[model samples]
Target chain A: MDNNTFHHALKIREDLCIGCSHCMNVCPTEAIRVKNGKSVLIAEKCIDCGECFRVCPVSAIIIDHDDFNRIFDYKYRVALIPSVFTGQFPDEISEKQIHSVMMELGFTHIYEVENGVEILVDAINKYAEQNPVQRPLISSFCPAVIRLIQVKFPSLVDNIIRVKPPLDISAGFIIREFAGSGIPAEEVGIFYVTPCAAKIAAIKDPVGESSSSISGVINMDFLFSKVLRQVKQKKSDTCAIPTSGELTARATCWSLTNGEASQLSGRCLAIDEIHNVIEFLEKIENEELNDIDYLELRACDESCAGGVLTTSNRFLTADRLRNRATNRDKAPVQKHPEGFRDISSEKQFLEDNISIDPIKPRSILMLDENMAEAMKKMDRVNRIMMLLPMVDCGICGAPSCQALAQDIVQNNAKIHQCIFIQKILEQKGEMSLEEGVSVMQDIWGFSKTNKYRDLKGI
Target chain B: MMHFEFPIEGGNFLKAGSASSQLKKILKQLNVDPRIIKRVVVAAYEAEVNVVAHAYRGIIMIDIDTSRICIQLVDEGPGIPDIGRAMQMGFSTASPEVREMGFGAGMGLPNIKSNSDELSITSEVGKGTTVKITNYLEQ
Candidate 1:
């Protein structure tokens, strides 16, 4: 793969795949196609939204993450967890208990990912104010949504606020804090417990920015089980685990829907789910929507709470986080322990480094780089569409009829791949039965095509 | 060149911008510059909405080639009595219902003019109106 290509954290287990088109049918970007008894992912078109992972019936789709033992390599193992991780637990599990359990599980320190939100809120508003021309500045909070814009809605790339998200901001702060304490950066490892594959991709192949501050990624579900198992086994103990600063009510719910939009001072709108975001962005691209200052878009329906790696129900996790925020607002602030350090002290450092380089648009819609060639290809695609059936049966392994047409134009697929065209060719003696079976075998594997005996009853 | 046509039902705010949306998809597939696509779509959408807000019915005709895209929206309804005044910003004769739906901002013509490379309007009072917008592919 080229270095410039997007790094996807979602992977398909070829050994376990049944060539089921479920993932292909539900993919928001149509990045998956079935071939040779397995679903193949088009890396360039995939945004790592994990929609395919959600729809995969056989659990063939898996998210790649850093090994849990990798954290032990460094002297200081810091687990940067989002609020949703704790939201997976019942209310009886206190935040301190969660932190203590994580500390027992080989982490030297525990930090809330939303701690960066305090610095980020001000930077986002300032960015929106500074760039008045880019109306309805889209949030860079969701990595999946950022990739969605890069691939699908390329024109709106400029409208995305050029700022690091809370994950990176918190990582930057923690790295600085470690440095201030005379701890070498190499000795400190900050691993983000991510709730989605998109975050893992973002950390591995950062957009706009040259590199990510976080060292490694640990999937939320993996860590949630580890922490929960320990919490259940051990009784509450007063173990003084070094922890980061507390999160405000606003910051606690910052990863939830409308969290950032509610803080920004303007006519802002919060939209979640990949399809809903795409629909709204289409209108925004067409200039149908106007006079909006900010837009908060998340790929998952309930924001981070609905991330693919989440173990709890999306609504319940969201409700729990909201309740936590409400309780935090009403409760009195408690004194910090001896090892607790306020992240606000590094606010100036974070704000100074908040702005990232401009994000470039990598449009996947075009057939070719050259305009003249693309126009020719599009004309050919349209002509091909006239011949193919419009039913979008997916027997051709493509998501829709239009997709197969484009694939044919691009030479990635054959015209006869369409079952409708195959039947016509067979009827006209233009193609042999053996040739048709071979094509089917090539797309669906020989087992599926040679299963005439299994279909006797049906 | 590729030619396409879509019929726009007037006074139907629900279906407004459908034509422009289709045109935008075609331009995207043709590898048009993002800036140019934005201009064409904005102008096309404005014209489409104008027909929906003021006309009884309209048909949008689009002609595209490697060099430029030309769009024509012809509608049959109350035509512009004074084209020059209508071209001015904040000048609208839209009904109260149209304004209520946020369609009659009086900036439609001006917006289309700014976004399109060439914009021409021909109308006969109480008969019909025709809007032609052309956008170049290259800067």
Candidate 2:
């Protein structure tokens, strides 16, 4: 099996899942179902937002980031680390110490994603000021949010800004510069140190573009222990990479919530958390926020700092980022490094290539294979729903009244399976309880009074 | 054709967009294209908000056939005094409180016109207003 589809970004380990339905209920996209005592993922319906991955109690959901061992295959490996990684450590360990630790981990070079973010911030500010789209241009930084819009609110597809994400921009720069460098093209590898599984999934299957230059993704949590070990070693070595001060304070702030909007000057709204993002996007869809210039939305609660894979407390990480930003006093340069300026600045971020076409909604009820038969099944579902109590009590093993009705129409469940429906059937004056029991036995293939209890073989 | 009717209580900000959300769900169950669902949702939501912001009470009636979905919002309220002015951008009769809450940016009707394939409005100044929006089911 191809690695990309082997288990998807969020994989459910059937042996560990307890079928509590917690993941199914909390999923934003409703992409999970409890069937036969296990949680099954509806692959096509899943946007891989990592909601289920975060809510799973038993750690049964595994992220499919690239194996760390893969780094050895290339002669030269460069790590593109998100700025949030700096805040994951103690403040005493300076930014310079972090890059040295990455270098010690077999990485030939460490390129902080913050640099790319600075250029992106500049690019966005210039684009929004010069060529504004329909009011409230939505930020396309979060891949999960982009996919959600694709599945849930495609009409707003035009609203998403067209710029490539910071990590991808960094990767694209590396790929563009590789030809001039003396190193063989095949020997160089680029890995993104990501805080969320959604980034890993996005690298493999991009929504806005045909492909990504990112070679692989490494979860921040996976590197937490490794970096800690290096910190304990306390070995110091001089590295060629520039420190956080080399980038703008605005770019480093991207690790914290509301960072993206802070870089722009306008009526920009920055919203975090999945639930709030949904509500805010609805307002945008209704044209209620037409006066606003930009909208920054993140899937994680506290933005990247609160990603599922990170071990550090989000609040502590955010405070650390603030402290670091204040300590760095250098101002950002208006011009970017050579070669990177043109690609990051000249391209229209909201152009045709980045605007994704709307996708069909997830199929919640496909009653039958044929359209006519499906219509008949829909009628059957409605009839069954009328007979149901419509309370959405999950006692019948379905999430809602509509789900139970759908199950009945599809022949996967019987109306008598509902306790209320069974009581109604038994209430008929002519039929005795025994007759009702017999009828239930015929339909359900189970005897109310078990003969096994009376066995005398012993 | 199928019909769905939902009552809308004016001044109920808590439940203002429920009807349109329900409409989106129903369209999804019927396997309507997501693009059409979005267009219908935007138009329906604008009409729903108009009813909530300016009317005493209203009813959202959705009629869906094989090829089209029609949303008719009829409300008992102080209707629009000038239809031409209402159709233009940045023209609203909403109260200051509604504007403060971000509901009246004067983009509702114009947004509906942009999202829908066909739209019609009929109003009696002191009696009521009816906004009919139609969107093609297929792309």
Candidate 3:
């Protein structure tokens, strides 16, 4: 609930962690550190990109979500599903069957999150037209990318489009519909079945906005398994649950890579994956890139299909979604069929509330808040950098020698934490051998340090 | 105050702007305003590319303090005969080869002038050029 620090849904369980340093090595922001045989996350530096979750070998990383029974608390339970969720299943499974299975599992209504995309496409173009100087308007679709910009590319914060993403717009539309039908807001609960940890964190602690209308978050893998189980056990398909209106081809593929970029008219480019995004952003920040009008950046490869909580292979999911979109484009549109709700009727209302407040930069790069003090600390860091071996061994509980130097100047770590420094001090008769072993024990945990067996035993 | 220098190799388009990138990192660590950092980096990048496109070899020296950042780019090459003409936009004496690689677009000096608070240039017609750029931290 503390908005000052980022709310990370990715939690590392110490009981299962072995301090293998895989997560530390893969983190794009260098937010992870090995301490006491466990990987610790620096919350302020994490953008919830799920890179650590993907690289964790011991399965110690877990994404937290709301309890399934929480949906029963409200009179009306509406599952806000994304297209990627449906793409997780085999091609034989129809979208109607998935909705029916969700209904059988106790959901009163099913709505596609991309229903808002019908309205967002126009909004994005309008936003770009109005802000002519803020070239290369960055999409706000990916929460991790938004947080990354705030933390790493603070100077480019103004380039992010202020319009709410499709998820929020869809949630707003559905909530308004329930209210319009005389259902009290408390009785209607909108639960978003999320594809990644970033979405959960965004719903729990949103940026540029105070709170989200989403009542709860359900991991995609959990719901995918539940629906798959029901589909397998079902004996008859005659439940006759009213299906939600089919999404347009554009809406169906809205969360995929190049989904938004292909729709926009300009010199737009879509870049997927966190590291690639960082690399491209550096060029943009340096003014090395020009004539770019828009950018669609996602934190995950293949976009939402490659979400950490997804069960199916990313390529297969994306392929299925692409096939589905192609089929939808070829099919004729049905006009107000049985139980089909037209979200387009609420487009005006969604457009009115599409804009969000300006996002402020929360840079974690500075050594100190005061420029004068930070300059002094930087000088000390440079001095320490010269003394420490730049081997980046990670034995010092920091990711690199530079990181340790910064930590030392910030008083979060000591200079002796570096093994190279410890040996130099010991040879000069400044510290004893017992002191050196204790330092290793403190960083790598007691058990790992105590078992200094000979390599010849094997 | 802190001082640092980075060497630049002329005609090495691949390594150009490395000094500006390093300077950008240092400014961010110093808690400089994001707008100010952008301007300082843009100016530095332009000066860096100028050295790569025109000079044979160069070095960038930077001095940072609480008040401002001053960057001096010195290059050994055929210096400009007319500093006034070089400062004008779209006035480049670069070869067609340099223009093909998207460098030596005469806007380099003009762009640097617009992005920095203060700018100066001194050149020995047959020897080299030294460009000094300063950006205020508080502004």
Candidate 4:
């Protein structure tokens, strides 16, 4: 019996697809069903996390995020730069160069996504040491993967590291740190210089509503090269970025080697590559392993530095980062920059991390039925799910065929979305064109008559 | 009470979650509270994926009763040798390839234990493994 879990609401554009199959390979849900040499996203099962958008080389997968021009609406613009940027350009290029370039790009000031990382690192370290019963604390940095776990791997949802992601942790800081000053938090716009589409999606549609201090996205791809040109002329500071530089080096740049997350012990389990993380997640989902005390997962295999937008060779940049980190002065900087390194406002940023309503997903009233009928329908749904392929292509506008089948089971959709149904009708060679058109009208809820004759496209 | 059995394909990672999906729909239509519904769904799905990824072949049987839901996954594959080791948090035998998909973080069994009202398992190295998990109705 086929009783596939489906991911709904993920889609792929056939017109735009290059058939690279990267989406097929990378899909954590395996919901993309390839038919007629193109991909379809089974809608029922897709988590709508947008992993496909990042890996698509031809820019085939699409999402609905706004452009960089949106920054103009804000009076005070601050950039929350992802640490992955340090690994993007050649290592010799100083952090000051990177920061100054962003400063040139309409951002009034910049804060390290690294500092947010420090907050997360400390939070996870403290939480893990204290709550020894929680097993391995799964890193919360990968939003797409985390969302997949929420919808598909609910049991593992609680297993997700409780600390806020570096991005959100930093956002919390941005709010109180800046707000503590005379500037109102609402008036100050925080923009994330993003490395991935997942982060952009996360900022817009947040997980756990941790109040992503980020207001909007300025994609690194659109702004990086322009920022680089500005950086080339900026002078390096020997003493200006000392404390920030020491902490922001190497391990801060990208996915650490094994035992990197738990620097306390090299024995900690480390896995990079988002796809790989999903596999481990499934293992955890299937009751295969749970003894791990720490699981360090990097969405990008080489870590965020391998982000598609970056310019430098990933290997070289990682190497240079390593060199710089090791060379860092063991001696403390004369003093942590008192002015910019603001902590007085941190008191306000320390807000409740726990969700007020953990059980809200079950609060919906629509999911109930009688015993006998429910069993019968369960059997029927399993039988119907088998005819569809397991690939989770978004072509059907569902994340996978299994998800489409879920919609069918829920009465939200029908089996006709499978594309094979139309093929079967064509294969039968028994119906007239008029009969087919009428069938389409009956099932598709549309007719030859225009719904809006005055519409511009029509 | 009638029992419905699904023949879960072994080593078929893609189709693993199907059984759980069917169970979830049934529970949902029965108007099960989203809380209880989720518990049953997660338990059933974890066992299903285990059958597909690790077993040679298996049958996922779902038995419904008044007070709780019971799922029995009986498999013919080489069963886990050290249940204790297998139950260890973050201990996974899934290959690097499997690791790529985020399925083998070794959190599955512990997570299942955490989600269910009761969990029991019996297995022999050469024979196979059967896991019985029950989720109480009121939870």
Note the Cα lDDT for every prediction shown. 0.90, 0.74, 0.90, 0.62
Model 1, span A1-458: residue lDDT tens: 25567789999999989998999999989899889878999999999999999989999999999999999999998889999999988878888888778877888888889999989988988887788788879999999999999988888999999999999888898889888989899999999999999999989998988888788999999988888888898876555543667679899999999999899898989999999999999999999889988999999999999999999999999999988888877884564474437777888888999989898888889888887788789889989999987999999999999999999999899999999999999999999877887898889887897565366443
Which is superior by TM-score, 3 or 4? 3
What lDDT does candidate 3 reach at residue A180? 84
On lDDT, the stronger of 1 and 2 is 1
Per-residue lDDT tens digits for candidate 2, residues A389-451, read: 988665455567777788677675667667678677668654556665554444323432345
Error of 1 at A259 (Å): 0.7
Cα TM-score per model? 0.97, 0.82, 0.97, 0.66
Candidate 4 residue lDDT tens string, B1-139: 4466888988887787877766764565555655677667777777777777778999989888646789999999889999998888898877676667667778778877877899998998888899999988864
Error of 2 at B15 (Å): 2.9
Alpha-carbon deviation at A187 in model 4, angstroms: 4.7
Tens digits of lDDT, candidate 4, A75-151: 77777776556656765677666765565566666666656555555556667776777666666666655656665
Best of the two (2, 4) by DockQ: 2
Individual DockQ of the candidates?
0.80, 0.32, 0.92, 0.24
As a whole number from 0 to 100, the lDDT of residue A252 in candidate 1 is: 90
Q: Per-candidate interface C-alpha RMSD?
A: 1.1, 4.0, 0.5, 5.3
| Chain A vs native chain A, TM-score per candidate | 0.97, 0.80, 0.96, 0.71
What is the TM-score ranking, best to worst? 1, 3, 2, 4
CAPRI-style grade of the A/B interface in model 4: acceptable
